[model samples]
Each structure stands twice: as structure tokens, then as C-alpha cells.
Target: MTATTADSVLTARAVLLDMDGTLVNSDAVVERCWRRWADRHGLDFDEVIKVVHGRQGYASMAVLLPERPMAENYAENREMLAAETADMEGVVPIPGAPAFMAALAGLRLPHALVTSADVPLSTGRMAAAGLGLPDVRVTAESVGASKPDPEGFLKGAAELGFDPADCLVFEDSEAGILAGRAAGMRVVGVGARAAALGPTVHVDDLTGVRIADAGGGEFRLTFG
Candidate 1:
């Protein structure tokens, strides 16, 4: 579903951002890798990618190849994905990423990156995108559970020295969004089209989104 547009700026104590689709444009690389993996396994590309977004690579592999040993599959996919050059075509900064990150830097609010991407993949993607990652980073290994479990985002909040209730979560996938909301933070859905679960606000991209850290209770946000 198309997300609801907001003109109101949200207030929060910290900001937590998703990496792949939210801050970095890994869509093409993700699409390419997932497609190759699916084709190798004779699985449907669309279906695999549908479940791939916002999930640890191994998590998606387990769901896709239920009969296979998940650990082995994860290893294989990790190896395959790594063999790919770090810099790939279509790898770039997501819309509004530069502005959003700069704004976060300027605001001086507690901010972090929470991603379903495993540490290696997340780091590679970030390097390819050339995005300045937040100091607080929560990767797949950060928690036993993945998105939709509230672990990743919550862990990120902790790293940022803020309570979940005081953080603002930015996500593009359903699992990520669910985790954010369940963690008790105001959710901001970022994507061209977000499947309608729900969130405090939704924007097509980070373009025009502004943030201000209000010292104590919350940080204020302005969106257009």
C-alpha cells in the first residue's frame, strides 16, 4: 500500500535508521544477488526477494530452502554474495540519504543504523554507497532475532544510549516496521510504496525530512 503522507514533524529523543533501502540504494545489488541465488536454486526470484528484504541472508535462505541445512545454505549464499565485486552497478545513495544523514549529523541527536544485513554484507554495501554510517550500528549478529522481532532496532537504541520509547525508527520493509513499532518508537516508513502495516509517519523518501533534537523529552522533526 502507498504510505500516508505527513506534513507534521515528529518529536523523539533518538533516530534509528535502516540501511539497505532506507539509507543506501542497494536495491539493484540486492535484486541482482537474490535473483542469482534464486535461479541457482530454481526458486522464484520475486517470491525469494519478497521474503529477502529486511531479513538476514541466512534467514531468507532458511525460509526459501526449508529442506536444506540452514547453516550450510547461509554459508553458501554468503560466499556467493561476497564473490561479487564490492562496487556494483546501481549501487548509490538512496534519495535523501545525503540530506538526511547530514541533517542527523547537524542535529546532534543520538542516531544509529539498524539492518537485517549481516555484518559483512552491511559493511560492504555501506562502503559501496559511500554513506557515512551512524556510530551506533546494529547488524544481524547484534541479536539472535531479526526484524519483526524488535531485537535489532531495540539493540540499536541501546547502543545509542536511549530507551526504545524515545527513539524514532526509520524502516522500509514490513518486518522492520513491525519491529520498530513493537519497540515502542514512532515509526517512519521510507519507500516509494510500503505495504500497509502502519507507522507514525510515511514519506516517499527522506527528501524534505528534517530533524531537530529537543534536549530532553524528544527531538522534533519537520516533513514536507
Candidate 2:
């Protein structure tokens, strides 16, 4: 949780990215769907949204409806995923996401998408945001536990053929920042929500991050 200065530089062999609030700004669609869910469940929409950002649908439901059956949560999660995937009206990339992704691709960097979104939902949302998918992806279906558990980031690092300590995670939620740390990786917190959470570095958006080859299969991430 070392905060960054304009001169800060982090070197890593691989990068792991979170989707929703990190790379894609899908808050509009998330609000629409979750608000409806909250109404149906007779819960507070404000409270529900607070817990929904970094978790999978079932995980979020379980938090909001602790007494609800796990079977019911899974069932409803399927429906929620469908609704989110089908509605991409307000989905857009976070600032500098397009260029950041392009820079990674152009540099042939080792990177993976580690998101709470399942395959279809991730695909649709990234498409809507006009962003390219990384070759390695650890989606909801790929992990048994959600963020704050560290499984996704660990798997992402393994798939990228790097040790967790050699990888850097870019995320925008408390759950995500915790997960990255638990995985023994450095994390770059993105967006306003992440500013309050302690990450290895904090940035308003991807625009504040500049990555350049550091030689020997590593890259240097300069942050402000």
C-alpha cells in the first residue's frame, strides 16, 4: 500500500486487470439493474450498490440478502448476468482505457483480464466499451471465490507464467485492492472509488499510468 508520487515507478513482469470500474465505466447499467433488484428484494438501493462493485452477482446477492438461500442466489445471478449482458446502453471505457490497452498490445506485454464478469458478460461489456480483450482471462466462471479472496489474481498470475509477486494488478474497488494484496501483488488503484483504498499506487484513471519496457521481460509502470 505504498502511495505514489509523480516520480513513482513500479516494475513488473505481468499485469492483471479488473473490468467493471477499473477499465470499463458500466456504472449506469449496474445502477439500473441493481436498483431494480433492490426494489424487488425490498432492500436499500444505496446500500446494495456499495457491495456490488467488485463481487460476482451471486456474491453481491449473498451480501445483500444474507438470509437468502445459496441456490436462490445462483439462480438470480444467472438472470442478473443475462440482464447486464443484454443491456450495454451506458457501457464505456474508463478514461485512457483504449490507449492503455493498445499500448499493452503494441508492447506485447504479458497481461490478463481478471474480472468478476463471466465470459458472455465480460465479452459484451468490453465490446460495448470498445476495448480489446487480453489473451488470458480469469472470469467469474474460472474461479470458485470472488474478490477479497485472491484466487482470481493468483490464477491470472499463474496463467501469465509469472509469480504473484512479479505481477501488478490494476483495480478500482476495495475488494479488488485487498485481493491483489492478499495475492502478494502490487496494485494500482484506479478511479475515485479506489482513491480511498490503499494500493501500491493510485491513479485517477489509466491516463496517469505510463508503461515502458524495462528490459529483461519486465516493464516499468510510472504513476502519478
Candidate 3:
């Protein structure tokens, strides 16, 4: 997203944030963990990652390792992946995320984090990424389905005390964008070249977005 793309036009009552690429730079951890899993299971690495990124563990495992009994693969892979990621370093905050989240707090705008990660991983990684917790957060455990299904974002909107239509979501992946739209919310595309998917607005990072109190129950957000 350009520096002056739509700073003047973007505003919302509530914001829904996707966790991984949107809020934090966990791509290194993800790539390393998944690559190891692929090697162990004799599966295709790139294909496995595409199916799994921003998705539930069991679901991704089922899609990538279809020949095994899912229950077994899910349990084992979850343990292995978690172990590998537990001591992860170099987990950095996404550009602009800290400022964006802090601005939300200053405006007191209702917001929630909606993530495909399980509870343990989500909390751990968010801390590692140096992000403050949101007022409401929906993890993979809270939903029956994953991103591209609308369940995660729908649950997040409810938890944050807003209708889906009253909220705007920020996401980096195509699946995350699809989920936000399915939930009837406008989406802001994040990350490298994610704008090609057509988010309501795009910004390079959270640092480029700001919020101000618009008074009388409304908040204003600007993209720069």
C-alpha cells in the first residue's frame, strides 16, 4: 500500500484483526516448522504450507496428509510443531501494528483479534511478537471451521460487541480476506502485495494507520 493511498477515507466503529501476517511476522517460524513436518511425513512442503497457513492444525493436516488417520496425525503434528515453535526467536511485530493497536486503545474503539491459531500458540506468539492483548480474541478452539469459512471473524465480531457489518477487518491472506467479506465486514489488506485481493483499503503496516476519537460513539481511522 502507498503512503497516501486512502488515509482520508478509512474509518470504522470496530476493527477485527487477523493475527499472523497481519499483526506479527511469524512467517519464519511457520516456514521452519512446516518444512520440518513435511520432511518427516514425506509430503510436499510448499503445498502443505499453502493449505495450512492461517488455518487450524487438524484441518491443515487433513488436507496435506490425507492418507493417515487424521486423529493421529493431528495430535502428533500439533505436538511437534508446538515444540519447534515454543522457543522461537526473531518473532517480530508487523510494521505499524503496535501503533495501530495503541491508537485503537486510545480511541477506546471496540476491537478483537480473530485467529486460526489455537489458544496456546496464539497467546505465545502474540507475546513473542510484542503485541498487547485485545479486548476480545477468538482462537481456533472457538470455531468449528477456519478462515474462508467466516466462523472465526463472525465469532470475533460478536465477542467484541459489534455486528459484523459494523466492523472492519484487517488481514494479509486471501483466506482471511474471504472470511472477513463473508462475515459482511470491510477488509483492509496488510502485508506484502496483499492489495491485489481488493481490500477496502491497504496500508504497508499498522504504523501507517491511526485512530482518533470522533466523539459521540464513533471513532475515526486514517491510513497514511
Candidate 4:
């Protein structure tokens, strides 16, 4: 879907961002890795993709292969992580993501990156996308549970020193949006796919988002 502006304005003391689809355009690499893994497991690639986005590798594997032993899932996840981290081809910033990140830094806003990717995978992808790591990064290694569990988002809010209710989350997947909501934070869906998931506000991309200091350590997010 083409990009567009959001109708509602959102305000928050801090922001929590999802990495993969929301900021970094890593769909090519992600799909490639999952497709290879699916082939190895004799599973349908399309079905694997459907359940993989916005989730930890092990979690996705669990959902896709519920009958498999946890040890097997863990071993496969490690292999997938190694393959993904080694393949940075096609990784880039989502439209307007660079500018949006700059705006956050310019406004001196408190923000955290909550991702299902492990440290190596997340760092490699972010570097490939030309984005530096955020001050607060909640990766798979940092959380016991992943997206759709709320643990990551809640941890991000706490790390940023904001109440869950005072944080705004930007996510581009159903699992991530649900996680944000479960954390009691208002969420701004970052793309058409995410918007369809029913976040509090929907934006085509970060291009139309503007943040300004709102005195008293608050920030006003103006959505187009």
C-alpha cells in the first residue's frame, strides 16, 4: 500500500520502537532466511512468513512446529540467527526512518528499541540499514518473552523511565502492536499491515510524523 498520513495526534513522554519492519527494511533477508529454514524443515515458506514477523525466532519456530522438542527449536533458532546475521543484503532503513530517528535525537526524546532479534542479528541489520543502535535496546536476549507477550515493551518503558501509559509504541506487525497494547501503551501502527491490526493511530510511514518538545519533559507527536 502507498504511504499516507495519520489523522490523530499522539503525545507521550517516551517512545518504544520495533526494529525489523518498523524501522529497518529487512524483509528480503528475513524472508530469505525463513524460506531456507522452511525448506530444510519441509514446511511451506508462506506459512512460515505469516507467523515469523514480530516474533523471536524460537517463538516463531514453536508456533510453526509445536510438536517439536524445545531443544530442537533452540538449535534451529541458533542456526537461523547465524544465517541471518551473516546475510545483510538488501537491508535498509524504512522510508523516513532515518529522519524520524534524527528527529527523536534532535528533540532529545527518550526512546528505546524493542526487537525480537538477538543482539548480533539486530546490530548487523541496523548497521546494514545505516542506523546506529538506540541508547536503550531491548533485544531477544534481554527479554524472557517476545512480542505478543508485552514483556519487551514493558521493559522498554521501564528502561526509558516512563510509565507504560505514558509511552508511545511504533510497530509494523500484529504481534508487536498487540505487545504494545498489552503493555498499556498507546501504539502507532507504522504501515498498512500494522494499521490493519488496529493500533490507536495509523501512519503510512515516519515521513509524516513530527515531534516537538512539549515542555515539562513531555513531547508532542504531530501525525499527518
Which is the leading candidate under lDDT? 2
> What lDDT is reached at residue 75 by model 4?
88
TM accuracy, model 2: 0.97
lDDT string for model 4 (38-66, tens) is: 99889999889989999988989999999
**Decoy 3 TM-score against native:** 0.89
Per-candidate TM-score against the hidden true structure: 0.89, 0.97, 0.89, 0.95
lDDT of 2 at 104: 93
Better of 3 and 4 by TM-score: 4
**Error at 111, model 2, angstroms:** 0.2
Looking at candidate 4, what is the lDDT of residue 185?
85
lDDT of 1 by residue, 174-194 (tens): 878888888878788888645
Question: Candidate 3 lDDT, tens digit per residue, 1-224?
Answer: 11234344555678888988899888888888778878988888987777776666677787776787977866975785576458567788998778777777876889998998777877888889878988688987789887888998888878777777778888998888988899998888887746788888877787877677777766667776
Q: Tens digit of lDDT per residue, candidate 2, span 1-224?
A: 23245578888889999999999999999999999999999999999999999999899999889998999999999999999999999899999999999989988889999999999999999999999999999999999999989999999999999999889999999989999999999999999999989887888999877889979998888876
